[model samples]
Target: RLPIKWMSPESINFRRFTTASDVWMFAVCMWEILSYGKQPFFWLENKDVIGVLERGDRLPKPDLCPPILYTLMTRCWDYDPSERPKFKDL
Candidate 1:
């Protein structure tokens, strides 16, 4: 469904797609993969996700996600797209 749960903050606010946004979506994908396809932000609707993210809320690490992997995931979800790590750095 390409839900809001997979969107980066910049992607949400500015409607711009970039490598950083791709990183953010990929991190969500990683979370989904590690969680065995569990939905990201299962409780939130599309409209709510933007405000939640603007408030600095992010997906919690899945129980199956390794701590080190979760750390990298959070870096990919950085509020500022420019601050996100490059794919090469991952």
Candidate 2:
């Protein structure tokens, strides 16, 4: 299982970490786990993460990412946060 960066029922601690946000994080962790701890988006510029997130961007799927999981990741990072899926369903 992935580690919890923050925990709260109503709100996650980080400014951007909600249940949906955690699902996104989980998607990344799942990639890492499947790849034996491989780094993700390593080539992405440092600014890219923030730029994409602020502008509602998503990371490109890594080669090893399975189709089902990729679909879930896309859901997690939906441009409208409300459109993101709940962690419970994941």
Candidate 3:
């Protein structure tokens, strides 16, 4: 099981997993890689992560992450799962 911080909000709220969930997690992984393994939402407790996401908050871009890459990450975290980009496009 993945940590809550890496989970898409829909999956956290509804226990529903889909290709979009994978896309969300992939973006978290990308953030990890770019941030040198830093945890996503490191400042928030696991239980609180969901509420933040529900409010449309996303992981802040790492200082060194490129703008284009950060844009991709944000797209992956879109609230509407259908709006998230597919892996092939990433």
Taking the tens digit of each residue's C-alpha lDDT, what string does model 2 give over 1-90? Answer: 223221111222245556666666676677667667666656565434455455655566767878888788777666555777887787
Predicted model with the maximum TM-score: 3
| Local accuracy of candidate 3 as per-residue lDDT tens digits, 1-90 | 657999998899999999999999999999999999998899999889998998889988988999999999999999999999998887
Q: What is the lDDT of candidate 3?
A: 0.93
Index of the highest-lDDT prediction = 3
Candidate 1 residue lDDT tens string, 1-90: 556789898777788899999999999999999989889988998889999998988899899788999999999999988899999998
lDDT of 1: 0.90
Worst 10 residues of 2 by lDDT: 4-13
RMSD of each: 1.2, 5.6, 1.1
Q: Which runs of model 1 end up more than 4 angstroms from their true locations?
A: none
Candidate 3 residue 44 C-alpha distance from true site, Å: 0.8
The estimated TM-scores of all candidates read 0.93, 0.62, 0.94
Higher-TM-score candidate of 1 and 3: 3
The predicted structure with the larger TM-score, 1 or 2, is: 1
A best-first ranking of the candidates according to their lDDT comes to: 3, 1, 2
Ranking by TM-score: 3, 1, 2
User: Per-residue error at 59 for model 1, in Å?
Assistant: 0.5
